[model samples]
Target: MSRYDPSAFPPFAVTVDLVVLTVREHALCALVVRRGEPPFQGYWALPGGFVRPDEGLAEAAARELAEETGLRAHTAHGQAAAGAHLEQLATYGHPQRDPRLRVVSVAHLALAPDLPTPRPGGDARSARWAPVGELLGRGGEDGVPLAFDHAAILADGVERARSKIEYSSLATAFCPAEFTVGELRRVYESVWGVVLDPRNFHRKVTGTPGFLVPSGGTTTRQGGRPAQLFRAGGATVLNPPMLRPEP
Candidate 1:
């Protein structure tokens, strides 16, 4: 036999945790599930499951999302059949994360412009979208009080989204396919938690090539003139990006 290191012990199983975020009622929300079994049983936690022996991490994440929330993988107009956007968030491999066994979890992040009614499945007692700020900032001294080290995973996902918004056109992922500049600004404000100057936001968005395309349409406003609507364009990165507020 070839001389090779065979004594290295492999860690326990790996899993995929998801932090599905959405702009609901003008606030940032994340999908959470109440655990049905022991080890933080009956408490709210991130939706996740063990990775299968035959699937990639991303595939497992998509599978868990569909199994738990009934959200399909892909649909037209960025609309999932269950109304959500699914993407990889990050991987958590802390050795002591799981109490029962050594488990590494790859977290995924999702975005949806419209909130869908969540239906719990698999090992979840209930599934719903909780506001990101509440989930991330309102927990007791333990910080999310989540099952496992999920609070850290959730924080990572949220920060990933916050940073992605500055460079990628991913903010549109939080808006409808066709939207007004005002609506787009609201997405930014909601995610960043800061108000943007409408005139400057409009100028920057309109001036950026392949950022927004005019739909040649207008909608009547409650008390003002009609506002023009535009659709998301091809650009994925902002050249001179809209910066996040300094904390």
Candidate 2:
């Protein structure tokens, strides 16, 4: 044991940026807020800020998520948490990512059921949930870009969502407390950006034991005959996995 360290490590700041995602209008949308101040004032970016010394990474992330989306943190179970499904997405420390200082961002990923429009928080000028393609300049936004390396962080989060739902019951995080199979299928279709065969999707999902529990009810919300309603089950990691169809 040696105590020969005096400021051995260079000064750096930690921040928590969120890639809050939801499926709306049959499209995958990410929560973005317009920066109200400089560096990239007026430019839309992920909702995040420096972590306070007293807060843990998850607490800070959940706080930011609540402030930006007006949805508080609430997870009764790993799959069907009453609130948004949250997890660590990735970390970005490219040195020049943040212009202000040597900053490192521990990014968090959130998968929420359809949510209301986001409200501006912190120094944000405005906030809204925009289609991921638009935010990435793929939906004809006139080449607009996110403030920092946020774009990459968001991309990683999207990929994680697309993949996680395959082997984990995480997709239910995008569904209501009690939802129809079609609703869950739509989540897959939107996030994967591919149309899924209704029959096959239903077979795979329902066939997976401990994935969805019957809610003892049915509804005709999706049209046609009444469809049974179900809730996320206790199982988190879905056995056999729901693989995406090849392109």
Candidate 3:
């Protein structure tokens, strides 16, 4: 036998976990699946799976997203489809995270304007969207314990979304292709969970150079007078970023 040896340690498996977020009935919600196997079977958890050797990290994230949620990644930007966005959230490699083996999970975050519904796939038993605030708290109404360390990962994704909105045009990812300033402000309010003075919000958004571009159009009110329409501008980051209240 040869002297060379390469089996000193156990093999590590890589996984992709997704924090799928959307605004539902004025509340920020996340998609969760009920585990179908051991190690937390029947408990709520994020959608995820083992990565194929042929795929890259992001490709694995996209494949898992499509398999679980029926949403596809955008071909142009390498994010989720238009009006939706996806990006790497963080990586979790804690030993014992997966009792089955040594697993390292690279988590991803996805934002959608709104979705029709979500159905579970792969190893999930059931899937549904739940409010973020409720999932984070314990003993509160609608509060349910999540499986594994998913609660902590979900919390991190929410904070990332909130902070990203302040500087990046990412808030627009929560809106349609075209929307009014009032609508855009609503996105911020819903995610931030704090009321913003309408006048101030309008001023801040408008004054920020290249933050929004007027579509030169208006729409009749759902109840009141007509409102002007606008679309997302070219700028990605807001220099002198808009500030949110302390949490």
lDDT score at residue 242, model 3, on the 0-100 scale: 79
Quote model 2's TM-score. Answer: 0.92
Between which residue pairs do clashes occur in model 1?
A: 89-108
Model 2, runs deviating above 4 Å: 1-8, 74-81, 137-142
lDDT of 2 by residue, 1-247 (tens): 9897859978899999988899999999998888889888878788988899998888888778677656666433432246568888788999899889899999988888998877776788788888887877662133567888888998899999999999999888898889999999999999988889999999988988999999999999889999999999988897798988874
The per-residue C-alpha lDDT of model 1 at residue 177 equals 64
What lDDT is reached at residue 75 by model 2? 33
Looking at model 3, the pairs that clash are none
Q: How close is every model to the real structure, measured as TM-score?
A: 0.89, 0.92, 0.92
Cα lDDT tens digits, model 1, 1-247, are 8777656776589898888888888888888888899888877888889999998877787788888877656534434444456676667777888888888887878777866878999989888888888877865122547788877888888888899889878888887767889888988888888888899999999999999999998877424788898888999899988788764
Model 1 stretches astray by more than 4 angstroms: 1-11, 75-85, 140-144, 221-224
Residue 235 lDDT (model 3): 92
**Which of the predicted structures, 1 or 3, would earn the higher TM-score when compared with the native?**
3
Off by over 4 Å in 3: 1-5, 139-143
- Find the 10 residues in a row with the least total lDDT in model 2: 74-83
